[model samples]
Target: MHKEVTIYDIAEKLSISASTVSRALNANSLVSKKTQQKIIAMATSMGYRSNTFAANLRMQRSNTIGLIVPRLNSYFMSEVISGIESVTNDAGYNLIISQSMENVDKEISNLKTMFNNRVDGLLVSVAAGSNGLTGFDIFRDRKIPVLFFDRAPHGLTVPSVTIDNENAAFLITQHLIEMGAKNIFHITGHQSVSVYKERTSGFKRALLAAGLPFNENQLIVTDLSEKAGIAAAKLIAELKGDGVFAANDSCAATCMNELKLQGFKIPQDVKFAGFNNDLISRNIDPALTTINYPGFEMGKVIAAKLLDHLSHKSDLHSSPLITMKSELVIRASSNYKP
Candidate 1:
């Protein structure tokens, strides 16, 4: 087996101090350019490699930010990740990303790994089944900055960056009401998730405000996946509401397509609305009205907030929540009667 090569070996072979070799390898200005070049060439010839992890540990920093999300297989998450990577790479920081797959145990395991690695900070969009910020107290105990985005829990001191789900849902419902929807059924995700819970609240609020009866069966709780959307369609058809609002586009589009197959005319029979202006919203026969939740922009802001705090440019302790702007988009799916 080949012997491992390190800086000391290079220094000994070149007849120089290890400090000089170290500075040269690290590009310290203290080492002369000519000497640094010689050291580099000798190090390369000796097959020596830099130990960045050990070096970063000695400096009490990782230059790495940990990101924990619920899942990676979605357009919204894809855009968010792209935005985060763009900023973090430009700032010379690395991201250690992990997904919980909507499992609380997996999320906890990820958090433990990030803590052990001594990440500079952590950004998390909690899992769907997460009860609350129980396992996350370790970061706070260590004074490690932690930020939550999108799917955060209620009553959190850990600052969050997310759109106002309640307000967006309320607006969507209100629009349907103004369009003469007497009964608006809402398709949503697990009620344990704050975003979905808030959306439900908004839907109910709008219905009550409009003096429309809020039916218990009108609110369907599902994972909001493609299959869940298809399954919910049958129940939606039985409920036979004049308006249907989904927490996301995937479910809304699938339900719309399924309802269409059942001979239901959109807008003319049932006005459809959804959150997250995903591509499917546009591809549907009559474009679906939705809330334009800016995942990419939210990602940029979340990374910037934690990075700024780490760099001592700002503090986030006082600011509990940062709300991103979500615009209500109107389309052919939601047309009002004169």
Candidate 2:
């Protein structure tokens, strides 16, 4: 095995004190540029590497931010993470990402690991089953900044960023109603989540505004998976609703496929709309009409806000909630007429 080079080795070669070498390596103001360059050159020649643990101890900062998400496989979540990475990297910060896999226990474990790592800040999109976060108290107690985006905890005082789910769902529902869709069926995920709850509420509100009867049988709550989509389509076919509003595109695509197999003429027999303009939405046989939720933009905004708070030590009380606008995209799936 190759021997590990140390600062003492560099100091011995340069005939300088280890303290001077340490100061020079850390780019401290006390070290002159000439000495710093000489020390760096000698260290490079000796194959020396800076000890991040020691440096972190000295600076009292990790220079790393922690991020926790439900899952990384979803297009929307992946795009959001990419956006966050872009901003954090530009700001000279490293991000440590972990997935909770929609499990409350996994989320708790991830939180503990992040806290132990002493991350400068944390960004989280809470998992599905996470009722409340008792473990996050470590961050609160330590005064580390924590920001939530997307699926955030309910009734928390932490800063959060999300889209206007109610308005977006209402707009999409209205669009379906205007296309001559009567008896609209709403397919959504777990009602425990604020996003799904708000979406369901918006759907009901749209029905009320249109003076249409809202049927409890028309609402289907599932796991928001492709399989759930197929199951939802079967239920929709049995119910024979004229319109279907799926909470997400993945489920919408699966439902559409199943409905097509059942010989239902899309848009003509059952006008359909989905949320989140995912790539799958456009690739489906009849392109899905959806709301552009801007996941990437949401991620970028959340990360930028957290970084700003860290740098400026700004009070988070000013903006408790940051809601982004969503735009509706009209595509073949919801276009009943030519």
Question: What TM-score do all the candidates reach, one by one?
Answer: 0.85, 0.85
Q: For candidate 1, what is the total of clashing residue pairs?
A: 0
Tens digit of per-residue lDDT, candidate 2, span 216-247: 89889998899999999888998888899999
RMSD of each: 3.8, 3.9
**Candidate 2 has which clashing residue pairs, if any?**
none
lDDT of each: 0.87, 0.87
As a TM-score, model 1 comes out at 0.85
Model 2: CA > 4 A from native: 1-54
* Cα displacement (Å) at residue 271, model 2: 0.6
Judged by lDDT against the true structure, how good is candidate 1?
A: 0.87
For model 1, residues 119-140, the per-residue Cα lDDT tens digits are 8999999898785576888988
